[model samples]
Target: MSKEQIKLRSMIITALFAAIIGVMAQLTIPLPLVPITGQTLAIGLAATILGARYGTLSVLLYIAIGSIGVPVFAEFSAGLSVLVGPTGGFLIGFIPATFIIGLFLEKLGFTFKNAIIANIIGMLITLAFGTVWLKIATDLSWVSALASGFTPFLVVGTIKAILASWIGIIVRKRLLSAKLLISNDIKQSA
Candidate 1:
């Protein structure tokens, strides 16, 4: 493929992942504060499959669409209000979380072990960001924030982390084998 074709392919995949994130965001187990959604899992999948730069791009695209009132966030919430809402930090945290997940995979190779570690770290980062913002936004005590935002998600997050790791590695390897994803360090697929 030419340079333009490669760029276009990557762009399409990035946008597709953004849409996937939106779709996954709808899968929510509602809680009082921040609900558990498939977003973090999708983020992990994006990172594992797309690598650092493009994975971050996918997340940025997802956030951008949601910020523009696309209703792409958890529970179909959207707009700048959602971005600055109590759970906004979690959305913003996705940027770093996605980047770090892909970065770790890029550095350590896209193995199940490394993906698990990366996803676990990413999950904690999201929880921390959301918990702090929840406290500040809701004027709750740190204890309350932890109770509602952080503590509630631990078990589910670990489960999602493992799933993201296992599924991500499998999909990534298949895509690589199929030449659908960019191979090695020379370029990115999406």
Candidate 2:
């Protein structure tokens, strides 16, 4: 395939994966305070497989789609209102969270250990943003924000982070192998 064709294919695949992440956000595990969603998993997967630029773009695309009343968010919520709501910080945090995660992925490369570290750092960034936003939106202090958002998900977040990180590494390796095969076939045909 030509270079342009390859680029186009990559963009399409990235968009598809972004859509998948959006869909995955709707599948939530209900909890007492805030429901846990599979969003971080999608974020990690997108960053790992698509690289930093494309991964961040895919997340931006997801937010854009959701903003336009797509019912893509948790519990089928949508629009700018949701963006500015109490949970809006977490929703908006997706942007920097994905970017930070992808940045770590780019700098650290694809290793299981590095992947785990990347997820931890990435989740920390998200928690920071979410906590700050929660505080402002709900008129609570930092301690309260952390109590509600970060503390509840500590154990489960660690597990999901590990799972997502490993999955991302495996997916990235598979994608690399497939790309090499495609490149070799193109060369042979040429």
**Maximum-TM-score candidate:** 1
Supply the TM-score for candidate 2: 0.89
C-alpha positional error of residue 125 in candidate 1 after TM-score superposition, expressed in Å? 0.8
Task: Give the per-residue Cα lDDT of candidate 2 at 84.
Answer: 82
> Best candidate, lDDT-wise?
1
Error of 1 at 182 (Å): 0.8
Candidate 2 residue-wise lDDT, 97-139, digit = tens: 7777777766656677777887777777777777788788888
Range of the 10 consecutive residues with the lowest summed lDDT in candidate 1: 181-190
List ranges where model 1 is wrong by over 4 Å: 186-190
TM-score of 1: 0.96
